[model samples]
Target: MIQKQLYFNNNMRQLIKSCKLGRDWKKNRNFHSYKAVQEDAKILVQPMHDSETRELSFKKNSNVLIQDGLLRFHSKDIKNNF
Candidate 1:
């Protein structure tokens, strides 16, 4: 009985370690916004088009939305510019 319990404990520890590592890896691999503005628990993003880079800039109070397991940015400025 003691040996069985030890085996179960070891399996559980390994499972927990693997889960933690997977979560950490996912967090590190994901893209995160640089800054955000929030009001009443709502997020507002202000993105600008970088003329040199030809990509959306997220350096200025840019917030992101995560939908369908993807990061999305929504703004009239972004739509009009791009």
Candidate 2:
């Protein structure tokens, strides 16, 4: 898949930074391992929501934050965005 330029929050930015700092934090390729969020000039991620289901991906540029293994995407009309 192709990845585009994106941003994230401070919390996520720190997470990515720490992951690179050592082997304590590992990266997930499928995007279901962790939650994701998007902000301006934050970090690289892919959390865009599904156009039909509105269910968001936990990918790097995703916006779904995991709250106890739950995927949450706040979108009224996800199709419009897609």
Candidate 3:
């Protein structure tokens, strides 16, 4: 009876250790997955930010060009009149 009790205790300890190890492995796996998702999100957002900046830059350059053209045109008209 004591031998049987010792065997039961040993099995229970093994089971508890396995359970704890499984939980730790699962937690580590989940943490890596979360980090991968965060990296992917950053990669996805970076291109959108770059495109938005480029679009804004293009618009500003276009406005500057248009204003320059208008100024030149007015200046030519004034020189011709004088």
Candidate that would win on lDDT: 2
Tens-digit lDDT track of model 1 for 1-82 = 1111112322210011000011111222244422333221222222222112222332234344343323344442132232
Q: Which lDDT values do the candidates have, in the order given?
A: 0.26, 0.27, 0.15
> Between 1 and 3, whose lDDT is larger?
1
lDDT tens readout by residue for model 3, 17-74 = 0000111111223232211112111111111112221111111111111121111111
TM-score, each model? 0.23, 0.20, 0.11
Error of 1 at 82 (Å): 2.5
lDDT of residue 8 for candidate 3: 33
Determine the backbone clash count of candidate 1: 0
lDDT of 1 at 59: 29
Better of 2 and 3 by TM-score: 2
Which pairs clash in the backbone of model 3? none
Q: Model 3: number of clashes?
A: 0
Lowest-sum lDDT 10-residue window in model 1:
13-22
The regions of model 3 sitting more than 4 angstroms off are 1-28, 34-44, 48-82
- Indicate whether candidate 2 or candidate 3 has the larger lDDT: 2
